[model samples]
Target: MTALQSRIEGHILTPTGFVLGVLTLDAQGRIADISGTPVATAAVRDSGAPIVLPGFIDLHVHGGAGHDIMEGGDAALHVATLHARHGTTSLLATTMTAPQSDLDAAFAAMGPLCKQRAPNAARVLGVHLEGPYISEARLGAQPPFARPASFDEIHRLHAMAPIRLITLAPEVGGNHALIAQLVAEGFKVQLGHTTGSYEQGVAAMRCGATGFTHLFNAMSALHHREPGMVGAALAHAEFAEVIPDLLHVHPGAIHTALRAIPKLYCVTDSTSAAGMPDGDYKLGRHTVTKCMGGVRLADGTLAGSVLSMDQALRNLVDTLGLDLADASRRVSTYAADHMGLQDRGRLAAGAWGDVVVLNRDLALQAVLVEGHAVRLN
Candidate 1:
C-alpha cells in the first residue's frame, strides 16, 4: 500500500457534525479517507484532540498584515497570509472606491494572483469590487470617488479579471440594467453604500441584485413606514454580508439580521492596520487611523475593521449565544455556498483539504490549505 500522505486525529466538524476521528489526505489536496479508529503512528499535529473545523471562507476582506490589496502584487499575498493565519482558508480580495486608473491598476496586478493563488496565502477566489459605483451618501470610509455605474468601465474591468462580486447603489441611473447585466455575466451584484428606497432596492433585486454588502452599515436604515434598503435586505436578500466586529455594528443589530435574513454571513472588511500595532494606515486613497481596536477615517467615519474571521466566530458564539455549528455555518458554509464554491466549505470527500485546528477554547492552533500545513508564525 502507498504510504499515508498525512493523517490528522482530532474532533472534526464535518458537514454532518462533529466527530472524533482520524482524517487522512492523499498526495493531491483532497481527503483520501477518514477513519473512526485511531492509529499509533505519530500524529503530525497533535493538539490534545482539538476541535477541527472546515477552514473559514471570507466573502469580503480588504487587507491585513500591514498591506492593502490596492497596493497589488505582494500586497495581495500579505493580506492572504494574515487572514490564513487567522483561519481564513479562502477569501475575496476586496477593493475600495478609488479612481478608475487606480482601480484598473489593482485589477491588472491582482488578477493573475487570483487565478493562481500565492503559496502560504489564503486562496483568493476572486475580486469583490466594492466601490466607485455606490452611493455617495453612504460612503462610510470610502474616498470621494463614488459615482454612478459605468457599464463600459465595469465591462473593461471584468474582462481584465474575474470580478465575482460588485457593490452598487440601486438608485444610481442605469443601475438596474447594470445589475441585470452583471447577473447575466455571473457576477454577484450587491446593494451597498446606498440611499435608495426600499422600493428601488426591491426592483434592483428583481433585476438580480442578490445580496447586500456590509448590511445595515452603509445602506439606508429600516423604517417602519418607508422600509428602506436595510429593510429590503432583511426582507428579500438571499444573503447579506455583515461586519460582526461589535464596533461597526451593534450585537443586537447582528442578532436582528441573523433572525431576519435567511443567510447572514460575517465579513472582516479589514484594512491594512489589521494584525499590526495601532497607527496610521491607508484604505485606498483615504488615510485611516487605527486605534483601540477600530480603524476609522479622519472624520471618525468607521473604516473597515481589524476584526479577523476567528474573532467574528467568537463574537457570534459568545456574544450572540450562537451555537458552534451555527457560527461555523455563518463563517464558512454559508459564504461558500453563496459564492457557489463547492469544494472548500465542508470537510467531506472530494472537497479541498482546507481545515483549521482550534483548541477547545476556540483559539487557532493550526491551519492547512490544500492539505499543506501553513506556517502560522
Candidate 2:
C-alpha cells in the first residue's frame, strides 16, 4: 500500500486507554481501525517503545518562527507550519488588541488562508479574535487599543474569515449584556482581560460565556471575600484555557485549577519569537523581546510566550506531575471537545488520521495531519 494508506505501530492512545497495536489509516485520511490488545498503564512509561497519541489541537495561537498572526499575508501560513513541526495539527490564528483598521486588514489577509491551509502547515480551523473588545484596565501584553464590544464589528470580521472563538471581557463596553446574544449566534465566547467582580463573572457565565481566557493573569485575582474572576472560574467554569509554561501560572495554581475545572486545557498564547533565537519581534503594535525562554515587553510585562505544544506537553508531564494520558487530554482532547471537534482530537473509527508519534522520552518522532506526514527538522 501507498504511504497515504499507512499502518502505524506504537502504544496507541485511545479513548479508554493505551493499547499495544497498529493504527490503520484508510485512503481518505481517516482512522480505519485500531487493532491491538490492552496494555498495563505502567507499560506506557516503562515499555520504552514508540508512543502514538492524537495530534495536538491548539485553540489559541499567535505566531511562531518570527511571525505574528496580526502581520497577516502568509504570516499565518508560516506560523502554522512552524507549530505543525511541534505536533500541533490544528490551531486558531489568534489576533491581539489592535485598532479596527488593523484588524480589518489582518482579517482580509488571513481569512483566505484559513480556508486553504498551506502544505506542511497545521490546519487553520478558524480565527480566535483575542481583542478589540477587552478591558483597557487589564491590557496584559495586548496593545492599548481596548474598546467596547461591538456586534457589528464582529460580524464584519467573521465574514472575512470564520471566527470560531473569541476572547472578550464581558464587563467592558456593555459586553455583559451581549454574552447571551453572542452565544445564541453560535460563537464560542471566552472572558478575559477584565476587572470584573466575581459576581459579575458568574452572571456573564449564566448569560452564556462558557470559558475563561488564560485563567488568573490579567483578570481579577481570587480574594477570600470578593472572589474575583479567577474565583468565579474555579467555582463555575466547565472549561478554561491556561498557559502551562510555568511562568504564566504557577504549578501549584495549575494543580488547583485542574481539580476545579474539569476541562482545563493548555494554550500557547505564543508570540512571534516562538521557535526563534532570543531577539525583538512584533506583537501587534508593540515590540517584544524573547529572553531567557520567555517573551516580554520593554516594561518587563510578559507579552506572550515562546512555548510550543510539544514543550507544553513535556512541562505538564515532567514539571506538573501529570500522567501521560491526562497530559494528552489537556494538550489535545479537551481543546478539541471545547471547540466541538469530535473527529480531529481522538483516535476512533472514522476520525481524521491526525497522529503524533513520540519516542520513549516523549519527544516528537513524527507528525501526521490527515494521514500526510509533516517534515520536522
Q: Per-residue lDDT tens digits of candidate 2, residues 83-168?
A: 99999999999999998988998899888888765678899999999977889899999999998888999999999998999888
Error of 1 at 87 (Å): 0.8
TM-score per model over all chains: 0.94, 0.98
Backbone N/Cα/C clashes per model: 0, 0
Worst 10 residues of 1 by lDDT: 37-46
User: What local lDDT does model 2 show for residue 267?
Assistant: 96
RMSD of each: 4.1, 1.4
Q: What value of lDDT does candidate 2 attain over all alpha carbons?
A: 0.91
Query: Which pairs, if any, clash in model 2?
Result: none
TM value for model 2: 0.98
Find the number of clashing residue pairs for candidate 1: 0
